[model samples]
Target: MKNMKKLIIYISFSLMAVVLFSGCKKSDFSENYYNPEKAVTADVPSLYAGLFKNETILPRYWNLYTFQVPVLGTYTQIAGYTNGSGVYEQPNNYTGDRWNDFYKNVMARYREIEKHYNALTSADDKEGYKLFLETAQVFVYDQATQIVDMWGDIPFSTAGGLNAEGKIILPGYDNGESLYNTALTELKRISDYLATVTPNNFYLSQLKSTDYVNSGDLLKWRKYTNSVLLRLAMRISYKDEAKAKSIVQGLLANPTQYPLAEDVLDKITIQPNSPTSSLAPADQKEIWNGFDVIPYPGAKMVNEIMVPTNDPRLPVYFTTNKNGVYNGVANTLTEAQVAEGATNFIFSRWDSTTFTYNHLLPGILVTPAEVNLLKAEAFERWGGGSAKDAYEKGIRLSIAFWYGINNISDRVEDKVEPPTEAAIMAYLAKPLVAYGTDNLNKIATQKWINFTIMQAQIAWSEIRRTKLPVLSFPNDPTSVAAPNPPTRLLYPSAERTLNTANYNAVKDKDNTTTKLFWDVR
Candidate 1:
């Protein structure tokens, strides 16, 4: 009897344990930890794209502030690079942060736009979203080509895709020239398509409503597309002057053809503040001097031109401090400026941030000033348009834009401190003789200064091309200095590890100062 009783109890306990174990197993199995589909969404396209547009505040931080404009932000650093100053240290190597992010997020958006457009059989839906998609594509090409230009070959055809039978497609680098040609073709195709298509309310409801340009107006879209064509032609000017000239002639011939951005307002200004925008980080301030961050304009080209011409833009561009002192750093200042310079210079930390927001990035897109400058540059090179006329026009537009005539900047001087159009025009018309190579360099140099924030890349590119705005490196650490202005960015290290085949293919020609395929000289 005792043995049977014990056996019964043992059986009961065994059954209970098994039941508990099964329940626990079911609970554990219910949790979905390995979410592969979600992870795939996180995959980025290219580090290059991220530099221009991305969710990370870091993109703006790096490109807009650190890499893009930072070169102009601090004088000492440039001096260090130029003359090999002992105190300077270079930033981390260029990586494909922008590229990766673009693939991850932007590509997805493009796919969605494509899907919607393809689904629409009618002209209305087709034309509407098509323009937006095409523009996005242009931006993508601009960004991608820029990336490949810096890094050499990159995964092009196979980028942002699932391989055959759902295999992962890690592509190899395409040729730089091929990529450039492709970009040009893509821009042209889109421009052509836009010519016939007229987007109506279809664009309004297609995507994020606010992001649509011109309310899907195909005419304006066509203009923008042609404007891009002009930009591309200019980009390859160094390598293919004939092509560049032809494209310029085509663009110039059409007056109402493609409306260039009339002023700084035509450029898109991102408002990263209200309800979380993506413009630029509001917290960050442009560092000038030691307090917030050091302000720099160490490009020798700019310094020489401004000092010699007695350009008024200098005071407007840079501030000494709260005290309104105008001398550059005593050590870096020229002998004459140093003699007359203010030692007790004071700049506003507030101004650093304010100046960029208030004065610098008003419209935030290609401006008429840029078009005029480009014309001036092309005329100077090709000898058709009046170089002098283009030069004066560039200066006048730039000065006018800076003074808020274009609604770009608003300077308050207790009463009326902003520059008047007449004052700016008079300044540009100042009867001063430009002599020697130094004087000619002044034209490009002034254009360079006027291009702050909006077109640093163009300025940098021109400096590389003309070498006119004679610039020097910061007199700091020169370990990894480019002998001169670097024409392109080096490929990010990520390429080597993940996409070794592609990265290694073009590694040979990835020099910082190496010209693009079209850069014949």
Candidate 2:
């Protein structure tokens, strides 16, 4: 009993000393310490690095692969492969760590960075500080909007608070509509702030080393900001046409103020230094060797779509099978059929030389193709310029992005040539591929194809919003949890146990069938 008392006293004294020392050398605490995993204060450079670190921005390729390819790809019919293990056989069974990753790892650190940025006074380099703050704000809007997009009615206003005193253990949910509106407002604020600064300014030069996304190129960051704003505005266009149109028009009216992704060079992507540095790839084997999420071109995508249209992207997007043909596997193959080798159904995987072999390849966040396509939709709905012009431009840009001038080499075995202008014109002139008077379907379909493997999540979103390029699972109705493709992912089960009351308020509505406010199909 005496020994136990002495031990307790020693621990108490140690903790007291730690507290006293921490308080006395608060400057040391502020400067030396940097841990994103915990809710501790970190320097701006460290925070910036944390934000772009593979696990933060792109995240573990497997987690994103699970969410993008297995789940969204299956739903959108971008990828198809048979798995009898029932891992991704049903919507209910489809799971992703994105919810936890976004909230805890990504958003939590973002909040900390914001808090640190806000704490800076005018005594600091005000211009440089503001630039940093604006950049952080862009991330805040991006991350928050993504959260709202994925799971409706998320805890936004009161989500990531320092729980040192345990005040905000259970943050309440904010309605998706309000959160989206808030995000738009925030983006506008960020854009306006970015406009006040120039890329060549000394303020931006300070951030060049730390800004992993754009290398402190304020202009590119601004363009990315405007592009995100355009994306968000379009996301709500179906539900809130007037507001969406107004925002879209305002941005389009002033290209100088709101620079969009006009060219492939302007596309938002992170070009990693090495495979270990980013989630690109160490070798082709790292991509093809993994069977858990091995992806093949969907049957409908290849046969009903690309083959018929003679899409030039076919060679760039996929590799030929053992039979030297670009075949595709159906998602609805039965367990018995899978066991029987599924009729030797070999399908195309992602072009290893173009993608997997290149370790320095950029991990795309948003593409110019996507922005131009969005522009096409906006113009189609509310005429600013010729919709056909935008549509053709979008298609051409997508082709150029993939095949023309990105400098990525083709597979030696495939001998695929870069798509030429004549070929692009010829492909676009096809009755099926050509832009009609009301070519929303054509535009959406092309966008879907462009997004394959590059931005599959956004492709899923486009499909959910427009229901274009109709996807069907011909066999095994039992594999699906609903008649239609799932609208939203079920909230992570951890929320129920961690934050019971708030989780209960939203849990009943949190199912695969629940459609987001923007998903008004």
- lDDT against true structure, model 1: 0.48
The stretch of ten residues in a row with the least summed lDDT in candidate 1 is 9-18
lDDT per residue as tens, model 1, 103-149: 54345345434544566687764555555566667656755655554
Model 2 gets an lDDT of 0.68
TM-score of each: 0.72, 0.85
Model 2, 40-68: lDDT tens digits are 55656567656665432442355445566
How high is the CA lDDT of each candidate model?
0.48, 0.68
